[model samples]
Target: MTSAALSVNIWSIPTTTAGTTRFTSKNGHTLDYRIHSGIVGNRWVKDQEAYIVRVGESIYKISWTEPTGTDVSLIVNLGDKLFHGTIFFPRWIMNNPEKTICFQNDHIPLMNSYRDAGPAYPTEVIDEFATITFIRDCGADNDEVINCPASELPADFPANL
Candidate 1:
C-alpha cells in the first residue's frame, strides 16, 4: 500500500530549522507559520499605499493611518503565518493563500468588490486618514520601498495582536 502523499505548498520550502516550528490546532491538526523580515525600510511614495496583513485572526485585517505618513514597512511571522506591509503580500493574497510565503493570512475577508458587474468594483470606505499618512509621495525623490532588508520594519508590534 502507498502511504498518503505529504501535502506541500509555498511555505513548504525554507521550512528547515528557520520556521519549521509547528502549532497544534484545537482539532489536533498541525499548524505553523513563516514570519520573516525585520528592519525599518522606507515610507510609501503614494497616498494610502501602505498595506498590512495578519494571520491566525478572525478579523484578518486591521488598519490605521495618519496624514503625516507611516514611513515604514515590514514582514514578520507570528505562529503559522507571515505579516507584512509590502506590495508582494497583497498580490499573494489575491492569487492563492496556500501559495503565500507562509500561508499565515489564509483567512482574509472575502469581499465582493463589484456591484453592477462593470469593469470596476465599488470601493469600501476606510477610516478618516490622509492618503499621505499611510503613503505620502510617489516620485523619484522617494525611495523605491522594495528593499527587503531596507524595507519599513517596525520596532515591535503589540504582542497577541
Candidate 2:
C-alpha cells in the first residue's frame, strides 16, 4: 500500500465561533472539540483542536494545533475489547517531524497473542507508537515506506507537511 494509505478521512471543519471546530467523518461520526487559546509557560499557546471518533468500542482521539506543526497525533482507547480496563494507548504520530509519514493498521491481532482471530486489518494495534518513515523518490512514481533506525530523511520529502 502507499504511505498515505488512510482508510478514514481527516476532515477539518471550520469553527462557527473562535475556539471550536467540529469534525465529521463519512461514517456519520461527529466530534465536537474545544480550542484552548492562551499562553502556557514561556511560549504562547494557540488553539487546541481535538476530535473523538468511535469505531466499535474503540474511541480514537486525534488532536493537534498550529504550534504542534503539521504532525497530527492520535490516541485510541480500547474499551472492553482486549483488556478489561479502559486502556488508552498511543497509536501513531502522523507526519512526524513534518516530513516523516507513518501509517498504522488498528485491526490486527497482537504480535504475541495466543488466540487466533480473523484476518488482520490495517487498524489493528500491532505495535503501539510504531512508525515508518516514508521517502519520496522523484525518479520513482511511488513512495517508499522504511522501518529502520532514526536517520536523516531524504531531501526530496516534503517539509512541514
Candidate 3:
C-alpha cells in the first residue's frame, strides 16, 4: 500500500505569556496552542514517534516526527553532542481515514509558582520556560489540552539543542 503524503507548519512563540495561538488551514481545520502554564521541557523525539511521561500529577503522551522536504540538518549536526538521552521515533500503521497532521517546534516556557514569603522579600520566580517541540495527530476539530506537572519530566529526556 502507498503511504500518505505529509505537510508541515513552522512558527515561533515570541514570549512566555498565557494565551492561545491559532493557525487556520485551508482544509477547514484550525491548529492551536493554549499556554495555560508557561512551564515547558527540553525533550526531543524522532519523527512519528511518541513517548509517555508523567508531569506533576498528570501523564501525557508526547511524540514528534519529521516531515518530507524539511531541513533537519541543524538537528543532525548536533546529534553526537552528548545529550541526556535519545528518544526513537516509532513506526505506525493506521487503517483510518487520511488527514493532515500539524507539527510545532517551540520552547515550552515553565513558571515557578511555589515560593516562600519573607519580610520585604519578593517571591521566587522563573521567567523562562523549557523548550518542548510537539506534534499533533489531529487537526482543529479536537480541543483537548493534555496537562502535566512541570516537575514530572523523564530522567533522561533527550535534549533538543
Candidate 4:
C-alpha cells in the first residue's frame, strides 16, 4: 500500500485580513500572495506553479519539487533563483474548472502576476466579458497573447477538456 505524504503547510490565513488566502511555506517564506479569493483557472495554472504569499503580491514562475513521497513537486522560475515546495493543489484549483478560474488580463497588473518563460509574458488584457467569451468560444486567436499548450500542462492542472 502507498502511504500518503503529510500535507505541506504552505498556506496560511493572515490575521490582518478577513478572507484573503496567504500561500506560505513552513519556514515562513512566501511564494504567491493574493487578496482575491476563489480558484484560479488552468490556463493560468502554469504561471502559478510553486508560488507563495509575499506581502500582497502573488509571485509566480518560482520553482520547487515535491520534497518527499512520490514525484510531486511545484516549481516556479524566478529570473535569478527558483522557489518551490512540496504541497497539495490549492482548494480552488481542485474544485473549479479551468474555464471558471479564468481571469481578465487587466487583473494581472493589479495583482503583480508574472512569468519568466519568455521576454514577453502571455497575458489576457481584453475586458472580462470578452475574455470569458474568448476562452469559451475561441481559443487564443490574438497575436498579442499566446495561450498555454494543453500538452505542457501539469498533472493536476485542469484538462484540455
Candidate whose lDDT is highest: 4
Clashes (candidate 1)? 15
Q: Please, what are the lDDT tens digits per residue for candidate 1 over residues 1-161?
A: 12111122112112322222111111112121223421111211122222333333311232333222212232333333443332222222233323223222221221112111222212222122111111112223222222222122345521211
At residue 128, what lDDT does model 2 achieve? 29
Higher-ranked by lDDT: 3 or 4: 4
Q: Comparing 3 and 4 by TM-score, which wins? A: 4
- The model with the greater TM-score, 1 or 2, is 2
lDDT of 1 at 119: 24
Residue 15, model 3: lDDT of: 34
Higher-lDDT candidate of 2 and 3: 2
User: What lDDT tens digits, residue by residue, belong to model 3 across residues 1-161?
Assistant: 11111122222222343212211111222223222222223222112222223222222212232321111111111112111212221112011101112122321111011111111122122232223233323432333332222234345521331
Which candidate has the top score in TM-score? 2
The C-alpha TM-scores of every prediction are: 0.17, 0.21, 0.19, 0.19
Candidates sorted by TM-score, best first: 2, 4, 3, 1
Predicted candidate 2 versus true structure: per-residue lDDT over 1-161, tens digit per residue: 11121233222222222211112222222222222211111111112234434444344445442222222444433332121111111222111222111111121233113112312222222222311122222221111222121123344422432
CA lDDT scores, all candidates in order: 0.23, 0.25, 0.22, 0.27
TM-score of model 4 (CA atoms):
0.19
